[model samples]
Target: MSYRRLHYHLVWATYRRRPTITRDVERSIHRTLRNKARELKVFVYAIGNVEDHIHLAISILSTIAVAECIRHLKGASSYIVNREHAGIDFAWQTGYGAFTSGDRDKPMVVTYVRNQKRHHGAGTTLSDLERTPDDENEEREE
Candidate 1:
């Protein structure tokens, strides 16, 4: 048997960073994301969102690419949200940020995701959050 442990901190925003995910629809969106994750064989350890963006701590299967998983999750959730809530055209940003972590840091990542509301409430915006090495590299390249 093969052993694999892959954890990712996934971040994505709504189109134009609009605050489309309000309190009234947050639960439905989260539920849809969870359902989509299950279909993709991904394990969602934690998921939380503020107004315009969301954070997910997931353990993805070795067989699935991170981008592919995110595509499905975002696509399905947007479809459901738009369907249920009329007059609201929901869509995700073109790109996403993904950072990989190990078992040792899983607890910390989960806590971070779970406390998103408190963090944002305290004026700790998403951009103010810690940046991964990938983020730094992207910044330099840009």
Candidate 2:
């Protein structure tokens, strides 16, 4: 095979630390993301969200750029949310975190995404996993 397949495990959060994703809003976001991915020929292995963040395990299409894929997912989902909940004031952060996954890690990533709500209940955030030294320094200074 001359070409290789790629999949990304992505996580992103709401704008300004807002927890706008209630049960209904979270479901709407997931559904919108699924439909957008399908339209773009991307395969979604798993998708789930907590109150403030979302996780997605998606197979990246060779023909599509990652930035473009993220644009469609983020933009469309944000629009859908604002439309559904007119007064909810929903928006996503300007940046997202995407990690490349190997075949062996696919199952692990899928399980993580599927259990996002449960994980959130345990008070774990993706940022917690990537806490930087600068973050700690800032925290200590405060």
Candidate 3:
């Protein structure tokens, strides 16, 4: 058997960063994301979100690329949300932030995902969150 351990911290915003994720829809979104992650064979350690964006700590298999994993999770969730909540048009932004972490940092990353509400509520903005090296390249590309 092959052995691999990969963890990633992923974040993405709603289209135009709109506050479409309200209290009534948040639970459904989280549940949909969790179910989608499972279908993709990714282990989701933690997931949390505010109004406009979300954070996820996941362990992905080597068979799937990180981008593809995010694509599946984001695509499916948006589909489910839009279908179930007809009044709300849900769509993810064009790009996402995916940061890899070592096993040693798993707990820290998970904690960050779990307490996203508190962090943002306590005045922590998205810009204040940690960025990966890829963030610079992705930003420049856009």
Q: Which candidate achieves the best lDDT against the true structure?
A: 3
RMSD for all candidates, in order, please.
Answer: 5.0, 5.5, 4.0
Model 1 clash tally? 0
User: How many backbone clashes are present in model 3?
Assistant: 0
Question: Could you tell me which 10 consecutive residues in candidate 2 have the lowest summed lDDT?
Answer: 133-142
* Number of colliding residue pairs in each model: 0, 0, 0
- Model 3 misses residue 44 by how many Å? 0.6
Q: What is residue 17's positional error in candidate 1, in angstroms?
A: 0.7
Clashes of 2: 0
Off by over 4 Å in 1: 125-142
Higher-lDDT candidate among 1 and 2?
1
Q: Tell me the whole-model lDDT of each prediction, alpha carbons only.
A: 0.80, 0.78, 0.81
* Candidate 2, superposed: residue stretches over 4 Å from native: 123-142
> What TM-score does candidate 3 reach?
0.86
Q: Give a tens-digit lDDT track for model 2, residues 1-142.
A: 3576787988777775467889889888889999999999999999977676677899987889887898899999999988998888788776667788889989988888898877778866455332222321221110
